[model samples]
Target: MERIEVIFKQIGTALRIIFLYKIVFLIACFSITTGWAKTITVCNTCDIASLKKAIAVAEAEDTIFIKKGTYKEFNIVVDKPLTIKGENFPVIDGEDQGEIIRITSDNVTIDGLFIINVGTSYTSDHAAIRVVKSEKFLIQNVVLEKLFFGIYLEKSNNGKVYHNKIIGDAQDEYNSGNGIQLWYCKNVIVGRNIVQKTRDGIYLEFSDNITIDNNISTENLRYGLHFMFSNDDVYTNNTFENNGAGVAVMFSKRIKMLNNTFHKNWGTAAFGLLLKEINDAEISGNTFEENTVGINIEGSNRITYHKNNFIRNGYAIKVLGACYTNVFEYNNFLYNSFDISYNSRINDNVFANNYWSSYTGYDLDRDGIGDIPYRPVKLFSYIVNRTPETIILMRSLFIDIIDFSEKVSPVFTPDNLVDERPKMKKIK
Candidate 1:
């Protein structure tokens, strides 16, 4: 007609200017995401005075979704960058003078709560999610039963204490405490938590680049994980069971303990890992099972104990007194009543190609080694080193007739503490 109605009015004015420039770029991204959408919803039949007046009129990227009963009120103070969730798991009964969630907020997130009476102290570290001087915080799936110190991170940093469940019916460590206590924190990442009957189920002092992996620190009244002077850390695959001494790394240094599982730390100054004054360390593939002493290296220096798996311990590796230049290679000293316990009868440490489930030498022409020399310090460990009541006749037969007459004349232990390439069997 008239040039097809002027090409349909010039393609309808270029499709209405491309639909008004995509509706003004979607209203400028919904006004920059509704300017950080603030949300506040609390109702367990409402009225804890209107849920503390909707968390005191929330702000800074707000979110206060607290809908589940038992908010028996205590000193609830959360200073800003909010997000105080608790869809269910809401019980903050702090009837013990103050503290029941006192976060001084940077980017806060105190999820699913339940914090019981925690007000004790000679100086007050009363907690149940108490992060003072906060930074990027996140205390996940919370549950802190009848506590004093359960998730107390003072002077916080880039934090992330995940999957929390801290129960502390702690009977005397002089009035229980510490389930996840970190002081002067740093870039922390404590994962998969389950800290029990506390008095120490994860206590780190002077914390640094911490990374405690896959945790399940059991039965605690002490040392389920106690780190002093903490340093560049990385404790992997954790499971420090039957506590009271299953993990303690004092005066720490560059530590990297992989595949961890330090078991039952039994009495008499128990130890399933107590490396005091540690230096450049690396204890790989760990699994010191039935422990009563399976790694108690003192004044550690240049440490390195590879491929570890010292099962059934009653003293598997106790090198007391100023230890130096440590190295025990290809380890697997199973069924240990005493594989290596040196109180310094002088043997500058190094037990090669180890695998001594009581290695009785002789591999003849089979080349898998052990044609003798596998003397891992017995002789009833020198009669329990001068009768600690002779260790209940350790593997009897009069301690195997004086450990086979001190393994053919090498009297009273540490005769160059051998393990010469001894792997004729049990390397499992």
Candidate 2:
């Protein structure tokens, strides 16, 4: 009977210990969900003078407010879920040491800070801010300058980068990095950012489901916006101007490029837009102006070019090879040196209902369409393809005679490559 009494006493102690554990867990969860989350302030005269120290003692869901001062720190890592905000635009100077702020946790937020002087490394991609393998992160209202890379997201998902300005004084492409770069990231929204003088203003590789909207990327050494191996991305209301080769989309599929402007991208090899090996894309309502070549397409297929305006370019569209099933319709080609240049003799793409300023055909019945078919590819363009130095005689009367002869006999240019229903008036 004494042994039975001892066994019952042991059972009672175990039950009491379990009850105490439940109470402790409930209190810890309540601190996170209720109003128990703390706010830590970092200032020059405070107890926590350093941002690194405030992050050290901060709990999950705490906010760290940084006051107005210059903090000479680098390699600061945020490994917990916290909100870091600057009160009066505090400056975080990296002194060209390394990456400034690196976030490795989910639900992290960084806002209203000015970061500069990121270290340049050939082996490592140092950035002013780097978010790696994190989800639902927000980096907004920051300014970055003198950067190797401004904001880089690697393997991150469901993030938003908004209202940031990144300025880089990049002279060459060998050492310069992109302003905003995403690698293997998905479902990211990048908006209202101004990026200039980087290698490529905004770059993406192996990323998907990204929306890049309302951004201005210009004056870079390479492309203003570039993407490769990315799919299901949408870029709208962006302006890409004065870059080396404006924008290049290679090896991508299902991309929607709408309502963007590509202007003043001029060089010997520069173009407003370059599409290489891309398929099933939509290029609509965009403006390509004053470029050497408006759009250079190579090995791209099934893209719909609709309602775009190509103005004052050397060649409005230059097709290299293996481009098939692409539809060009309802677009305006105005004051271009050449409307279209095709290298191959076979014509597999469709060009219909486009307005050409060089079209001299008459509409006899006034049905809002030209009665004669418009041959976009001229024979001089074919000769310029073989001998580029012959472009000096582009405006001479001799070149015009040969182009008319080729139109009459259909010798060098593709005979079937003609717009049957050319629009009599410009497309609105």
Candidate 3:
């Protein structure tokens, strides 16, 4: 019985030793597979000559290097997790055929590529690079020109799009698309991009928790940055200039726009910033320069506008209707034709501690605050709202006399609309 027990113990020891060796072998194989991942090179003279062929044979988490040459490819779908890096800004011309690159998988990175000529289609929203339902993606250092839609993100999240240049030649709105558009996306960072001459430079629809900073969007056919139903988004240090309508924030809540520059957006319906149906937002430290209207507000409520500089605009702030509980303080309204134009006679908004360049009131006590209340709404502006043709008499002396009379007696404009504590000097 003792000899039988010894044989059984020897068999158990051998089985344990075999199991340990098998585990070590499996770990070693995994390490080799991870450390020696394949890199497919695509060029005119290479084993993998085309991007499509390289992607077809590439394993998961492989790297694909594209050489510096024009690859006329369209509808190139990236359905696997890979890294595509360009050697010297390789051109990916779509030949005006269709969509350029579509990414459907997660954990993808595309860098240093110049994509152009995305075909225009009324039925399909083609894009230079469309990231659809992907996560943990990075699309950076890319240049897109003559495209329909540049970097369109649809239902994608956790992505970064940085340092991309999108220059579109859009003549009209119907035939054009947006530069950087995010639809139903979240947790995305769009920074350091230059988008010009598109329908809308940066457009967000139903997107949340987005950060758009350090971007220059100018010369677009429509609004430079257009937000619709997007909430909890912050856009700071961006420049929107010379667009059809500068920046339109509509139907959005809890949005913060800080330290942005809106300049030189002039048209019949142009404005530096248009807020329609927006609520609970903050606009601070912004500059509105040389725009037709500094801000065109309509049906917005509970917004705070502070420390903004409105310079040389046609109307500094045009309050159309149904805007209430809006606070405007520490703002510099300089050289505006009309400081504030109110369409309604009832005023529930607050405007205080603002520096008006046209304020002629003298401070006897020299406390840097005007003792007399400054009425910003003018009767001539009210008449101009009714009859836009009367704007020709804006600089006439007769128009000034009527505006002065309306200030003394609150008949045509809102009586309660006054800046009681107006600043004597310009706001720094």
TM-score of 2: 0.91
lDDT of 2 by residue, 112-139 (tens): 9999999999999999999999999999
Ranking by TM-score: 3, 2, 1
Q: Which pairs of residues have clashing backbones in candidate 1?
A: none
Candidate 3: tens digits of C-alpha lDDT, residues 1-428: 99999999999999999999999999889978776567888997888777888889987799999999989899999999999999999999998998999999999999999999999999999999999999989999999999999999999999999999999999989989999999999999999999999999999999999999999999999999999999999999999999998899999999999999999999888999999999999999999999999999999999999999999999999999999999999999999999999888888999999999989998999999999999998898899999999999878999888888888887988889999999999989
Candidate 3 or 1, higher lDDT? 3
Which prediction has the highest lDDT against the true structure?
A: 2
Q: Could you tell me which residue pairs clash in candidate 2?
A: none
Candidate 1, residues 1-428: lDDT per residue as tens digits? 99999999999999999999999999889978787556788776755333456668887778888877776676677888788888778787787775677889788898988788877776767787778888899989988888878888887999899998898888889877889988879888999898988988998899988898888888897789988998998889999888878888999898888999988878777788989999988898899988889888888988889989999898888777788778888889898788877765777778888888878768888988788878888777766766778788777787788788879988667688787788886555
Query: Which of the two, 1 or 2, has more TM-score?
Result: 2
| Residue 169 local lDDT, model 2 | 97
lDDT (Cα atoms) of all candidates against the true structure: 0.83, 0.95, 0.94
In candidate 1, how many Å is residue 112 off? 17
Q: Over all chains combined, what TM-score does candidate 3 have? A: 0.92
Instruction: Say which candidate scores most in TM-score.
Output: 3
